[model samples]
Every structure is written in structure tokens, then in C-alpha cells.
Target: MSTPPPALATPLSGPRFQQTSADLYAQMRRTHGPVAPVLLDADVPAWLVLGYREVQYVVSNPEIFGRDSRRWNAWDRVPPDWPLLPLLAYQPTMMFAEGAEHRRRAAALDEALGAVDQFELGARAQQVADRLVDAFAGRGEADLITEYADGIPLPVVARMIGVPDAETADLVSDVYRTHAAGEGANEAYARVRDKVRRMVESKRRAPGPDVTSRLLAHPAALADEEITEDLLHLMNAGQLPTAYWIGNTLRLMLTDDRFAMTLAGGRRSVGQALNEVLWEDTPTQNFPGRFAVHDLRLGGRQIRQGDLLILGLAAANQDPLVRPVPQASTGNQAYLSFSHGEHRCPYAAQEIAKVIAEAAIEVLLDRLPDVGLAVPAGTLAWRPSPLFRGLAALPVRFTPAW
Candidate 1:
């Protein structure tokens, strides 16, 4: 006999996804096993893969669970302007591409990102950090999320991808809107898409040492639309998670006694804190993930063809079977913060993001050695986002240096 679905589905959004998700995931695991049923924004049903082994199996075995969003069985229930269409709607980009086509685009993206000089990128991040800190240093207090952590990645990424200086701010705004899934998300996605197309045209006219130029000139010989669409994927995917990574790390350093003791000049601990955040508080919590290729059993649940499986990255990291004790995990990079397998975030891109985040955190500490949370740490609010984990605001106080 076939296994039946759970009686009630957990909504992927709202307070359940907020501060208490660890508890929530625990409940789901107890009630529904490794693969728990879930409902997206508009009552669209899917499964949240919560076990470490189960998540790994799903992402690694793409032959069974594919990346093609077009194969989703719930599309008929989705509206054209559904807030999540920007994320779920199929695009020709490598994010939704599968098989040989995915390999083609992934190769170009990997090579292009790999070509970036890590040392130069680190130096560039420091420079960006210095300029940003300069703006808020004399104020004695600032919201680090808006003024610091949220500000670092986009400018560095824009320069990396050859987005013109003048256009970077607007691009940042649109990307934020689309990721936040606000009322204007659809329009924001359209604007960002058009902007990337124009950027590809500009790069073609005069190729530079940027990622876009490299993609255009790569041996893969990607077409304009391919490059343009992937660039949109590249920019949007790179910025938000990275920004949240930085924010979450800073929050850890400020709030936790383990890291707070290092606030003054514990430069070495910055890396430790960053690694811990990945394991405990990964930026991308639940990735809208692979669709089942055929009916099969996964983690004791009966999965159907075209069934969507959300890879629970955070929940998987917390799986008792894999995670080490808290003290032992500071140096452990075994976490699945970056999804695993063929379609995982490229190794090259992960290194670049680390350089950017580490530099942002280190530079802030170097400049404002006494920086501490301006509000009671307990009062800080997390952004009301289901897909990403980040603080809505990170206010801090420091001695004025001017």
C-alpha cells in the first residue's frame, strides 16, 4: 500500500519560520518523519526535507529529484502574479536549467567566477568597508544591517559583475524588493531583468575584466539571453544571502559571550564565528528545491512525480545525526549552508562570498574596536522572511572616532 500524506501541512512562512524554527523542525520531524508536508504562500503543497541524509540524497540524486521548475505539479494553482513567481517561475537561467544545459551554464559561471583574483577581491572589500564605516563612524551609533552588513556585498558584487557605478544603487533596491517578496516584487524582478540585459549589451560592446565579460567570452560560448538571464541569477543569488551571512555573524559576535569576548581584536575568532553561523544560522534557510522525477519513497514518505521538495538547509544542519557538539563545530565546515551535489553553489562563488563577509566583519571591528549592540540584544528583530534568515535591523553603539 502507498503511504499517505500528512493530515495538516505546515505553512512555510510566518512565525514558525522565525526565531523558533529549530523547535518547529523538531515538531515536524517527530510528527511527520524526515519529509514533512508543507504549504507555500497560496496553499500550494510540497514537502520539507528535514533530515541531513534525506536533504543530501535529494540534492545529490538530481536524476530522481530535478532542478527544472517547469515540471512542478502545483503550477496550475499558482497565479501569474504570485509573490513567489520571481523565485518559482521557470527561467532559462542555470538556476532552473537541468541536464547538459545546466552543465553548460554551470561551467561558464564557475570559470568566470574562478577567474576573479581572491586577493584583489579581499582588498576591494576592505576598501568598500572603510568607505562605508567612514559614513557612520562619527555618529556614535548606527543600524549595522542597513548601514554596514547590508551595504557591503552589492557594491563589491556590482564591480565584480561590471555593473556601472551609477546603476548599482537602483539595482540594489530592485534586488531587495524581489527577494523580500513585497507587493512590488513582480515589477522589481522585471526591472532587474531589463537592467541585466542592458548590462550584457554594454559588456559585449567593450568587454572588461568583470564576471559578465568573462562569461561572454568563455569557451562555452553562451548566447546573449543565456548570459543575461544567468547574470540576473548571479546577482540576485549572490547579494542577499551574503548580506545576511554578514549580518548574522555580526549578531553572533555581539550577542554571544563566546564571540562577544573577541569583539575588541579577536581577529582569529571572526572566522570561527562565521563558520558557526553557517552551521547554526545559515542565511538561506529553506531553498525552493528539486521536483521529484517519479513516484518514490524518500525518508519514509511517499513522494510523487512533480512533487516539490524544499531543501531544509538549516534544519538539516541541526540534524542530530550529523552535527557535532556546539563547541566542536566552530572549526567544522561540514555544514550544508551551501547546498551539496551537482547543483550546489559553486565552490568558487563560496570562496568569494567568504572573502567579502570576513572582510566586512574584520574591517568593522578594526575601525570601531568597542562596538556593541545599541539595543538590548533580546530586542533585535529578525526579518519576517521564510526563505532567508536575517535581522531586520542591527543597531549598535560605538565610540565616535572623529
Candidate 2:
């Protein structure tokens, strides 16, 4: 009546696992066409869905694919005092919930975010961009990732969520690094959890007109703890990848003369450029990890209950079968950069595009005629993280048009 799970195998060691995972993806694309079996972590045993179609299959089918963090073995490796389990326990937000709960929370968020005036937000974004650009206008060279990309998103998020100015900077910084790859990820999570708990308590006492306030006002719809959880999810979701997207888009345009020239001439649509950036180098390379709830077949491989399943977003976006049209063109081929289906990021793609185009790109293009990367293209360093791909720092030099 049901398909049996695939045979589970232990993953390769840490360093080998990372290299092997990357290699396996390349090999799968070459051989299997779009989807292939790969491993998740060195110590944890899990199957990675490295093709676009397979990822879509898993993401869209929650009955087969579950997003509960409890399914992950990485939990065992976390320190006993780590805040991850408590955070998950206290707030099973949409990301960690399944079925109806996930859908309900997602709907609420969509309504709240959608109700806001995007055009007004765009005007606010322009002001934020102008201030940031002015801060480094005269400097011939600066780390765009640190000075510009990272700084722009914080104020916007704070305004969106009603975080006070004094606490915004530290809170944004802690949350950004919480899920980052490396040994310090756990510690970062702890800091983020503490900050979030404090912020939630503060919001509960004095709710304002921000997203958090709106959630609190609808207490009958969601519990306080659930509200906190969703806030944390929004904070993490809104900050890190958006920062990476901004950095990556700037880097891509700076290094590629054609892209830069096109943007400069105003011929290239900002929306198209944003879409191209998402497809070319997705900020989140891997899918939000999911688990097989029952015996199931995906990409011709059988998976059983409790088995960990990872959907590869980066691999999926490049699927030949999916055949995503160039960002400049209009078509219906699926792209997995922000993912698809129930658990996918709703505002992630649009939010990134809006901020970068209306805020960052518009400011930069007007002020700098030939903004480009200062370091050699080959020398740029990508932060080593499987879940997200971005530059550690992007150094650039430009002459201000003014």
C-alpha cells in the first residue's frame, strides 16, 4: 500500500561531507539531469534532494515532507544548555509546524504584510539608501557587504517590526548569525533567542503599529508564545538572506560589465536584474530541512518515516528541465530561489527586490557612474555555508557622479 523508505546510510565526515556534497550536486546535474541523492551533514544521516523538480515535489507535499526541526539529528549535537530546543518548544511557528497550523500562520502573515503600503515603504527605502550612500560617498574604497548591504536592512526591519532604535542594531546582528554555518552557530542562536525573548516581552507590554503589534492585537488568533516564535522566524527570515541578496546583487553587477552597463543605461529592468540574481546565485542554497512523515517515493528513491530530507534550492533553480527563462524575459517555468509551496518565503523575493532596487541600486547608480569591485573577481571569498551562499566582504571603489 505504501512505498518503503530508502536504506539509511551514515553521512561522510565533516570536511569530506561538504566537499562531497558539492561534488555530488555537480555530478547529479550532469548524470541524473535534475534530481539526485546527496548527504546533508558529515555526522548526521540525511538525504538531500539536489534537483529542482524533486525539491518542488518535497516542498509542495507536506503530507510526505515535514518541516519539524525535531526530525533533525543535529539537535543531538547541540549543547545541553543550548537555546535551540527551548526556542522551538516555546514557539512552533509556521516553519516548524505542519498541516493546518502552518497554513493558518502563513495566511495571517500574508495578510498583515500585504496590507502595508509597498509604495510608501519604497519611499522610506529611498531615504535609508541615501543616508547609507552618504556615509561612504567620499571614500574611494569600502567593504560594501559590511558598510552598505548589512546596514540597509536593519532599519527597515526595525521599522517594520517596531523595534526601538537603541536595540535594533544589536538585535539584528545577533539574529543574522544565528543559523550561520560553523561551530559558533549554536552560540549565535542562544544570543538571538535571549534577545527575542526580551523583545517579545517588551512588545507584549506596549504594543505599537508594527508587525509584532498587529500579531499581539490578534491574540485570539495566536497564542503569545506563538507570536514570539513567528517574530523570531520573521526576524531571521527578513534579515540574513536579504543582506546576502543585497551583497550578491551588488557584486554581480560590479564584476560583470554588461550587467553594470545595462543598469547604468537604464535599459535593464531592476525587477529583471533581481530575478537574475536570485536564479544565478540564490542566497539560501539549501531548502529549509524537512523530514519524511511516512514511507514515500521522491525522485525515484524511497524514503521512510522519520527520515531527514533536504531540498536543494540552488540546485533546483538551475534545473534544465525547469528551464527558467532569463529574468529579463516573461515565462512560467518554476524557480526555487525563494522556494515554492506552503512553507516557502512569501515576502522574501519581493522584499529583497524592493529594497535593493528602490533603495540600494537607485542610490548607487545615481551617485556612482562606474561602481565596480576593487578586488580581483577570482579573489572574492564566499562564506562557507551550505544553507546560504554570499560574500564575506565585497570591497569596491567608485567615483561619485556628483
Listing every candidate in turn, what is its Cα RMSD in Å to the true structure after a full C-alpha superposition? 2.0, 4.2
Per-residue lDDT over 282-323 for candidate 2, one digit per residue giving the tens place of the 0 to 100 score: 787775478777777767666666666667787676665665
Q: Rate the local accuracy (lDDT) of all candidates.
A: 0.89, 0.66
Q: Estimate each model's TM-score.
A: 0.97, 0.85
Show where candidate 1 strays beyond 4 Å.
Answer: 1-6
Instruction: For candidate 1, write residues 250-369 as lDDT tens digits.
Output: 999999998888789969799989999998889999998899899999988888888889999998988877764654664768788899998899999999999999999999999999
**Cα displacement (Å) at residue 177, model 2:** 2.4
Would you give me the overall lDDT of model 1? 0.89
Clashes of each: 0, 2
